[model samples]
Target: MYDVDTRKRALALVAQGRSLNSVSKEMGISRHAITNWLSRLEPLPRTPPCVRCLESPGIPEDTAAYAYLLGLYLGDGYIISKPKQHYLMITCTASWPGLVDAAEEAMRKVLPWPSVNRLQRAGCVDVKSYTRHWVCLLPQHGPGKKHERPIALEPWQQAIVDAHPWEFIRGLIHSDGCRITNWTTRMVAGERKRYEYPRYLFSNKSDDIRKLFTDALDTVGVEWSTLARGSDPFNISVARKASVALMDAHVGPKY
Candidate 1:
């Protein structure tokens, strides 16, 4: 059992905006313990007002985080906003604990007052934040599958994406993209030598969403091409050495 001082320090770190996962790792304390401490001391409260609902509605203060979340939402995330239920859910693979933590942290940064939780499934974890104002922030939430509908960013969101292109790219990569290396053996003089080609691939069936991703790539000067299998163009690939370098510096591989 942790002492009073330990609990205080953990809460203090959380108050300073550190994530529960990070705090738990640092203090060697389980997140359940820290959560129990918070629940005992903090009172149940109403959900906080969304910034977009203010008299003078404005974009989220942390535009970079918002842009990143937007990319993730468009990639594989979704929002549910029934009368009694409202939340944003981003699914991260269970294997990537760091990515799951990062997803929850981004949710908190974009909307600090929401209650964020994780739902673990067979091979993935859904990082969800409960709030009714998700619709206010993510206007793209709609009734059908994302691929069947038009996906266009509002001017304000576009501005944010333009400003923080790398974060947006990182979120997209983390959600629906991957970095891989392909190697082939070739004859060098009399010996067979192996060479590796590293590339980044983003696969999505939605035309509009793919356009948005490629447009962002264009803005960031990352050379990419549509990779086709047989007759279907279904993936975007960054195979050029310089473009791969740029993507590595910005997005890297998911944890």
Candidate 2:
């Protein structure tokens, strides 16, 4: 076993961005031994049971049962889980052709009511089709009147939104759909401007559903702008693109 001083030193090295392998080597300890010591030294804190469990009678028991079912679905859904993973789970069901509706309904039923509202206020559910499979994503909320800047996306969510297009394109030539692509910073009139909102783009082949999509965008008060004209000559599909531009362009850029 390593001494307390050695453990503290190793932790400090890790805080300074030193690799675990390098830290173990520097401390004259085996990497596996260091990993074991670290795991034993501090275990991750467990999530507390939902507050509803204590406040509402009977609801907790039902919620728990639903959560268990949800966990099973998550384990067997498009994504799988690990043997050692432990987390609270919840499940909901929707019709086959209505995946987006199902996801929203499931989320409403499974999550605490407050959480559902928070998710909706942040951004609505987005549905995308790739390689014949429908993928739906619930976006995070943007900055509001109280907040000076837009909220940042979680790393996992950001990765999914960023990489999905490339992954889809690589898999099939005809695969195209709406995607949230970039978060960019720009300069306007010698002032630095930060735009933290997610940008949505519709591919050329999405013409079939453009009207349906545009109506939804209008309902959300999201204004669309044309970034480019015409379709890719090689693709021979009319690619009409639109963007939200900024979450709070009305607020203007902060100096």
Candidate 3:
């Protein structure tokens, strides 16, 4: 009878693209025995159980990725959970391909078991990951739009956001925020001078989501304020010089 070690060696050789005959000859095992071992090899796991749904029900191991994903979801992410369809989608602008890649990567890091793909829209790319567990991971899934409903984080999710504030902020900025430089010219000592104002702006129609962003900014000691162009006070501006510097250091542009 072949021992476990021998069986493992033969299987390893076969896994490395070696033919059954070659493995049998190299390991001094019969072809029938090798075939039997291969057949008995347990099927690889299809999809791992959601860590947040287990009996113990713990937070995701990659809290940083989870936090970032949470921010992206709050900003421009969508979840469709139904009897026939389920997935998590994050919309990224086609102009910034890097954000699309980052969104896909964050989804993978948070839930590596599912399949992630990019769908190109008219002017944007949708990074989608298929899994019903997304609803479990993000309880904010509901029937209405994000701004139309109450979006709040659970205790565990809040803990992750608090722990990785920068990652979370980065995700939000990458999804719905922008670092823009507005400039003006002024006559200084009879010479035309250019003054550049570089700042970060996070815009969302949901009041709760804007509050969450401000709360995270507060946690990170980044001063921010609200801006209203006409009547919609849906803009959070991190235009303070110090705060802008801090944002540049951590969350910079969405490239």
Question: Which residue pairs show collisions in model 2?
Answer: 67-89, 70-90, 122-141, 204-239
- TM-score winner among the candidates? 1
Estimate, for each residue in 24-119, the C-alpha lDDT of model 2 and write its tens digit: 766797778767766777633332343334454223223322332222222222211223221221121212224334333443443332122111
Off by over 4 Å in 3: 1-46, 185-187, 190-192
Steric clash count of candidate 1: 0
Candidate 2 global CA lDDT score: 0.34
Per-model TM values vs. the true structure: 0.81, 0.23, 0.80
Model 3 — which ten-residue stretch has the worst lDDT? Answer: 13-22
Misplaced by over 4 Å in model 1 are 1-45, 190-192
- Each model's backbone clash number: 0, 4, 0
Candidate 2 ranges beyond 4 A from true positions: 1-31, 34-81, 84-216, 223-255
Supply candidate 2's per-residue lDDT for 1: 67
- The Cα RMSD of model 1 versus the native structure comes to 7.1
User: Which wins on TM-score, candidate 1 or candidate 2?
Assistant: 1
Order by TM-score, highest first: 1, 3, 2
